[model samples]
Target chain A: MEIAQIATIASKEFWDRIRNRWVLAVALVFTAFALVIAYFGAAQQGAVGFRSIDLTIASLVSLVIYLIPLIALVLGFDAIVGERERGSLDLLLSMPITRLELLLGKYFGLAAALAFSTIAGFGLVAIVLSAKLDLNALYHYFGFMLSSVLLGCAFLSLAVMLSVFAADRTRASGLAIATWFFFVLVFDLLLLGALVVTGGQWGGEIFPYLLLANPADVFRILNIFSLDDVRTLYGLATVFPRALADPWLLGLVMLAWIVVPLGIASWRFRK
Target chain B: MASSLPPNDAGAPLIVAQGVRKHYGNIRAVDGVDLDIRSGELFGLIGHNGAGKSTLFKMMLGLTPTTAGDIRIDGALVTGRDFRAVRRTVGYLPENVVLYDNLTGLETLWFFARLKGVSPAEAGPTLERVGLAHAAKRRVREYSKGMRQRLGFAQALLGKPRILFLDEPTTGLDPEAIRSFYATLRQLRSEGVTTVITSHILAEIQERVDRIAIMAAGKVQARGTVQDLREQVDLPLWFSVRVSKEDFEAVRAALSHLQVEAIEAHDDHVKVRCRREAKMAVIEALARLDGRVRDLTVREPSLEDVFFGFSD
Candidate 1:
């Protein structure tokens, strides 16, 4: 594919978000929420000062699991379907660019916006807490930021895929919300309910593998498994085997979450 | 104005479609149609809504795939691997062209110009060419419908494309803007740019286009110059002969022996209708009246009349 054509479309999407302050607004939201959870995470136990980095990250993970996917889906659900509904798809398709280039460009551009906001918003918290922690704590914080970006990218890819398959913006949006509800809220509950109803005898061996099916759970494991204090505190270390907790493996799974949906979007858009 | 061009057969065919067909289930949007559009020619494609003119236009631009046949631009397949090169030389203005409302008029042109690999610097002059220079810095959301149409025309004029495909381009423009729009088209024609336009306003393009294609029921019913189509349909011609109230019967009596179809008298003029071949004979009969016929004018079938005759 021609990179120049891709860049042209990507830059438009990127600048549209930048100029409208969408990135800034999201970044501010991230920074505010992270700082609050960092300082006030142990308030229920009568603590108010900046807590341990492990506890801060654990609290932040809960917030991000629900927030990032929703932001990504809202950002990208209308990328293609909106153009079709507004009657501009014909003009854009008439250009010299290929359908693959347009799809990739749109994905990369919005991904950049989401990544930038996630990094800036949470990275600011990392700086404020750096004086209280050691290098290992800073490493974990940076890892948290990176994984958050990947999670957003994965959800954004799904949003774009829905945009291509949907006939109009209204339907695309409905599909996006339904996707959010499935991955972020219902997937894990259904798995847990199955395990409980079966009394742990039916899905004990496959339960950890099934957790990888949801990117939100994957993000949770990726962050929570790396910290020893929080790993025992969250108690998920019992069910999830140490062999599957490799940071690189979980990162690859997250990358798959981003790539597979984008690939499907590209294929469907070309048709 | 279209008469200023060279003969119809002068230029080679720049766009060729061969038995192209697009079928959606049982509906034949474009069915086995073949057409050739010559370079430096202003061609018009006129048809009723849902007659498949837009579908055919999309196929020619490679925006929609043809299910059965092929469309080639400049000897290259429109949907081939090398279509990027073909697309660079073409510009299109879709019907009811929609642009981003958040961008300024100049920014809209720049966005398209960059996509076409043209320099963003060209956006200024392109907007000026379409009479949108005054609103270059204003957001498109603030523009009126006529202004938006002009901006869409400006976007199509970017990159100096060799061919232009305009679909109902003058939809919301006033009469003055429509004149200016066609004037710009005439200027482009002199530079050897082939234009294929579709318009519901047949009268607006009858005198401007070099050749016309009338489509109906997913097929081209007639294709030729306006005069050629008029003759092809064999529609009647009319003559308005000015005569005094007293000489009305005398004027009618002059053509009584001829094969005139109908004769009706108003206050001071007699309207005579006849076949295309009887034009000269009827005129000669009126000439025999000498000063009795003070004035005489012949009216051929209009483009709308011809459109209805073919499309209906």
Candidate 2:
């Protein structure tokens, strides 16, 4: 709602996190991750070399969807609490800016940082795919990056919310990490179990609704956006057709996760 | 800086509160109270532990909503909505002034400056003025407590606020830092800034503040100038006279000449305080007597007396 304040905070957050060792170190770590994906995607020059597209796309998809959100949580879980503990919040309040400004600033900062990391890390994926192969997967690769970014934003918003509401930064960080684990590592298992209990009947209709709650669903849909050219193959060959069925609707739903949680956090910050 | 605020009958003061309260569950911190702070006056809030000075400050700052009554600034009522706007004009420094650990002093300064819409070039001079220009390039993590305090001051002073709030600004500071901090406050006062400082150390704000409010049981028990607070108590003044060992007996014998109210004889001096207005007359009367006066000090009742009297 407050534009100028949000821009200022966003710029500061972006620049400040850029200098954070944890954030910067993760970027380097992601750079290495990009290389690993490229190697696995293309190293099979002779043995089962189903072309470099398969392995690289799979690796980039997995890293972008799963790993990036975790990185976001790691970075943002202390956005507010860290300032409060350090007593900077008190000083910040004394300034001419409002708490809403502070909230929007912090969110924008984290988002900007994520954008940088996403661009650089996934740009590397695009680079490798473009150079090492026919450079055909560039378009799909960005789709993965864009979807991953939107999903990551939702996770970052949740992290910031936890940071503000929890009693302390340590507890906030712990809760943020736990939430990430539930979505990334455990939710899929829970979904599969639910589908199994219904004897595969649940997988068709009701399971998709269940998937919406998990932040991973957004990433899945975005990844489907990257594979638009091969929708027919996905239906015939891959297990990812669930997201491919109607990607646009899924994209909007994923975006809602980002906007809604952050909206609540801005409200809570004022409170 | 010695200017009086809005005259004595200048309508409602800039900040007024009636029966303001804050209750954090069982701990009903700030009970019902009334406060009136005139514009441009340095008002000090003094209290013992659990007296709720900080709680009141938080309520006023809109960090926490008040349980009851009203808090206003510049005639604008502080509903939850106006917190951001009100905060812009109110600068605050907490007891423990910590800053962004990873940011350089300059970096942190610029960050706040940017928030206030100040350019880095404009902020540079302020960093220097706070005596941290040389240290600006250094990370705040490497800064000393005093340095951080100054940095916090710089941040708080960014907008040249109308109302400034500080909670125990002298906690970790050394004597020199304390003095400079006061000097800075004095400068702000000269700039017509209204400051409300909460501190347990009465002596710290004893001379600088225009008025002080002493809080107990979550409400202001007494509020006035140091001289006025002294009047509220059963304060009788005291005079201390120091002389050579041989002159002790003579001064004791001459105590009757001054018609003194009470006398407590120390090893080297005699202390006297009377209801009579003529403290100088006693000294003059002592010179005419057999007493040999080496030194004399007339004692005014300390802030401790005022605070402790209310404590009881």
Candidate 3:
């Protein structure tokens, strides 16, 4: 009911985690990666040693696509139920804020923290790549990185939703990890199993919708979203389905990842 | 603190719990209990373990769902969809008061104060009020039990809440802290804050609260002023009358005249628990018998006695 109240709650939650030790630890790790990426780029500057730009691109893809969601998971899995276990749920509930506000506050707070970390990480990467990489390429890299961070936020929102539904923090953490595991490692395997069972009858048609459901696919699409040539990466000499590889569809998928789980969490939190 | 008008003058009761019930499977935590907490008063709810005190308090805070019945605060329903509005005016302090162990006391206070919409300057005075200003810079992990209680109390008092639900607020507090805590509570009462305090320590709350409610077996068996509950105890003014060796027979014979045969004879003394009407008769009969009464100690009915008496 109170937007200011929700924002206040979010500000507290955000700053608490922002000042946490883990954020500095993440920064240290990001700094180390920047250093390594810098050296790798400088060594391959003149002659084609290994394509530092491509390595930078790969780093952007894996670091944002895979690592950030895991980071988000570690941050978000215990958001709600942990407060309940600590007996501070009573404290939060005493305020004039509604359950929707509380959940949204927590969800937004975590997303904001993850987004801030990503921005910092991107800034540090840019500082390292300034000597070799051009400004235009750096802009695209930042955009893809931002999308990955947003996807990570989507996962965090889903985790927060799971945390609310769970009876306790431990169960909530387990469910969050299981969801991340499904999206990251198990979804494709399960889909392949389904395709094998159906004998490729609906794989092409159903795969797009299913991939849209998977945030990792969206992250991967965002990584190559700003590329000048997307069709070349298909590796298929004769057949490249343009629909599955559409950048606009990737944006739609990224938007879905951000909005759908958050909507569900808000609804579940309504008193 | 809610108002400066008058004590118990508000037509709108601070808390009106009518047939407020909650059940977990077959165990009814709060079973059909009606409670009215007046304005500007410290209301004590004393009950033993599993007596549903916590359940009732939780229902008032909207922490746990009520199975049936409704609680009204200034005529707003404390159940169903409108509970959020009810929660606005209420502050709660749980028994365990577990805060973020990683943050400094000042940071924690500022965070909760910010969440409660009180300014940072407002937080400083609150911490000082609870006597936790010195330990504000220390992390919660380093805080002693009493200090954490202080912080918890300060948080609950923020924004000048009209209603406060304190669940065992002084469970492990030291004697000095308890004394100081009660002083703060009295100050809050003067400020017209309506408080519902739950505790197992009955004696500490007797003079602290304006009214008392004794709960047993998920039901409130007695609810009224200290004297009101004492009357429900239905026990007499008991006394242990001691006499000299030479006057033992005279005292025993004197008690017999007042129909005090149910005495626990201990050497030269007799302990008698009888109706209040028989007290004066026994005393006068002792005087007539010329018994040398060395000492007499009278036992009065407190909330504990009232609860256990009616609990039977």
**Chain B TM-score against the true chain B, each candidate:** 0.93, 0.87, 0.92
lDDT of 3 by residue, A83-183 (tens): 97878887787766677788888888878877777777667867766777777767776776677677777788778878777889888878878887888
lDDT, residue A269, candidate 3: 58
Q: Estimate each model's TM-score.
A: 0.95, 0.86, 0.90
Lowest lDDT sum, 10 consecutive residues, model 2 chain A, at A231-240
Q: Candidate 2: deviation at residue B112, Å?
A: 1.9
lDDT of 2 by residue, B5-119 (tens): 2322333387888789998888889999899898778999999988998888877777767888888876556655665566667777877887778889888877777666656
DockQ of each: 0.87, 0.51, 0.56
Question: What's the C-alpha lDDT at position A172 in model 1?
Answer: 96
lDDT of 2 at B99: 78
Candidate number achieving the greatest DockQ relative to the actual structure: 1
Span of 10 residues, lowest total lDDT, candidate 3 chain B: B1-10
Q: List the residue pairs that clash in candidate 2.
A: A9-A105, A10-A105, A13-A109, A14-A109, A41-A56, A96-B88
Task: Point out the higher-scoring one by lDDT: 1 or 2.
Answer: 1
| Model 2 chain B: ten consecutive residues of lowest lDDT | B1-10
What is candidate 1's lDDT per residue for A1-271, written digit by digit as tens? 8898899899999999999999999999999999889888889999898978988899999999999999999999999999999999999999998999999999999999999999999988888887998999999999999999999999999999999999989999999999999999999899989999999989999999999999999999999999988898888988999999999999999999999998998888888
- Give per-residue CA lDDT, model 3, range B1-312, as digits (tens): 233323346434778888888988999888999988888888899888889998888888776678888888877677656665556567788888888888887888777766666676777788889998888888999988888888888888877777789999997799999999999889888877888998888888888888888888889988888888777676777778887667767666767757554777688777787786787787777667543777888788766777788776
Which of 1 and 3 is the better model by TM-score?
A: 1
Q: Residue A53 deviation, candidate 2, in Å?
A: 1.6
Candidate 1 lDDT, B1-312, residue by residue in tens: 122223334489989999989999999988888899998999999999999999999999999999998999878899998788888888899999999999999999989988888889999999999999999999999999999999998888888888899999999999999999999999999988899999999989999999999998888899999999998999999899889999988887888898899999899899999998889989888888888888989998999999999988
